[model samples]
Target: MKTVALVYSQHTAQTAELGGRIAAAWGSEVVYLDPDTTRLEDWMKYERFILGTPTYFDGELPDSWDEFLPELEDADLSGKKVAVYGLGDQQHYPVSFADGVGLLASYMEELGATIVGETSTEGYSYEHSVAERDGRFLGLVLDPTNQPELTDQRLAAWLEQLKVAFAG
Candidate 1:
């Protein structure tokens, strides 16, 4: 199956770094695409997708994601499996931690894709997030700025979750 990682980042490159880790965990041929250079057509060739982005001010995706999502409206992603991940400064934006995850995930969900990588909110200290549903994040939420030490462990666990989610 073809897998791709589409990433968008501004300022800190933590979102890109997280994409790399996810690609590595997949242990397969995974193509990496950055928003500026990535074409919506290129995304259509993949069966599995891993999308990452940094949450902008309050609860929103970066400019690139804003530009990219609408492009996907014409693409048919039915039956595709997607895993979403995001970076955020939970301390500063606790009320909307990794909110872009929700925005992005919603677009994918609308496109008829199945979203994997849902994670618990246990280790996080955020007050609210658009990404949260039923006490769980829509995808993996990592805080390289506040809890860098937990990134590896969280990624490992989420990777395991993806394996199971993808299998059944």
Candidate 2:
């Protein structure tokens, strides 16, 4: 199995919690990296990555992600595999739910990374989201504040999908 890095902001409680669950489910092959402390060079060590973020203030990326943007942009992720997951409250922020996932995935794609692990939009009640592309979410979207019950199942399925995508 390829080494997978699960990068996320430790500042956000929900995002951090979800990242932990994902890393745990992914077993020993996955390592957790906090965007706040992880160096830009460290990101290049992993060929496959799972990025997590929490949407803040009208679909904006969190402070940690904002600060890390320059390093992420500078990194050459060509031919790398990346999957994004985001935390949002569909009930409260339906208009821009999980927008952070879409934003991050777009940036990675622009850097020549292959974004994978798209998930269906079913079972989610959201007015609209940038994360949705052709009826599927760009990656996993978890709402721990609202739809907490589905998080486990969603993570399980997304990890399985990542295993296949990373293998290829």
Candidate 3:
């Protein structure tokens, strides 16, 4: 089975860029889709998934991701490996910072996938987040709006962690 990196965003390319970087780092196929684009199928062919999206409208995922989520929910992803990465303006939406990541992680969890890449909440300055569970972000969280300089470092670290997790 193969690994897939998928992403959807409406406004900026940051989310797509991050997803591409992840796919490159992992040497996997990266797929970018809009809400109205062709739907992804054959879930059972991919043993692992790395997903990315941007938070929208007060802690919600982009419309494309929201719409695509139902398909994922319907898939039998049990025993698969999954991880999420998301972009959010922590300073602006502290209450819902990276909530999209949390939403994706929760869905994967519910589908019985082994979620990987849980990140520490130490560097981020958020009041509350759906992404936080057990004092960690549900997955990777990037804030290009607030801390663009750290994106590379954070991505590198998270990718390293994912490599280890994927190997185990």
Candidate 4:
């Protein structure tokens, strides 16, 4: 299995918690990297990455992720694999639920990274979201605020898919 780095914003409690859970579920090969303090060179060390973020007010990317955009843009991720997970409140912001995942995935794809682990949108109640493409979420979309019960199951399934995707 390829070494995977789970990158997230440590400042956002929900995102941080989700990142921890993902890392634990992924086992020892996964390393946690906080985007705030992770150097640009550090990002190049891993070819497989799981990025987590909580959608801020009205679908905005959190501050730490927003600030790290330049570094990501500068990095060369050609042939790399990235899976994104985003936290959002589907009940409160249905129109923009988990848009951060889409935004980040798009940027990474632009940088030549192959985005993986897209999930079905069947269980979600969101009206609209940039995260949806071709009727599926760009990656895992967890609504812990309204549907915490489903998070674990969703994470498990997504992680399984990622293992296969990253292995290639």
Q: What is the TM-score of each candidate against the true structure?
A: 0.90, 0.95, 0.87, 0.96
Evaluate model 1: give its TM-score: 0.90
Off by over 4 Å in 3: 9-12, 28-40
The clash count of every prediction, one per candidate, is 0, 0, 0, 0
lDDT of 2 by residue, 14-70 (tens): 888888888877899998888888888888888999999999989999988888888
Task: List the candidate 4 regions with Cα displacement exceeding 4 Å.
Answer: none
lDDT of 1 by residue, 19-47 (tens): 76677777765777777667778777777
State model 3's lDDT: 0.78
Model 1 worst lDDT window (10 residues): 3-12
Pairs that collide in candidate 3 are: none
Point out the higher-scoring one by TM-score: 1 or 3. 1
- The order by descending lDDT is 2, 4, 1, 3
The list of candidate 2 runs beyond 4 A from truth reads none
Query: Which of candidates 1 and 2 is the stronger one according to TM-score?
Result: 2
Question: For residues 1-168, could you state the per-residue lDDT of candidate 3 as single tens digits?
Answer: 244545555454888777667766766344444543535464455666777778887988777776777777667677788888888898999899889899889988888898999999888898989999999998899999999999999999998888777665
What lDDT tens digits, residue by residue, belong to model 4 across residues 1-168? 878999998888888888888888889899888888888798899999999988888879988888888887767899899999998899999899999999999999999999999999998898889899999999999998899999989999998999999988
In TM-score terms, candidate 4 sits at 0.96
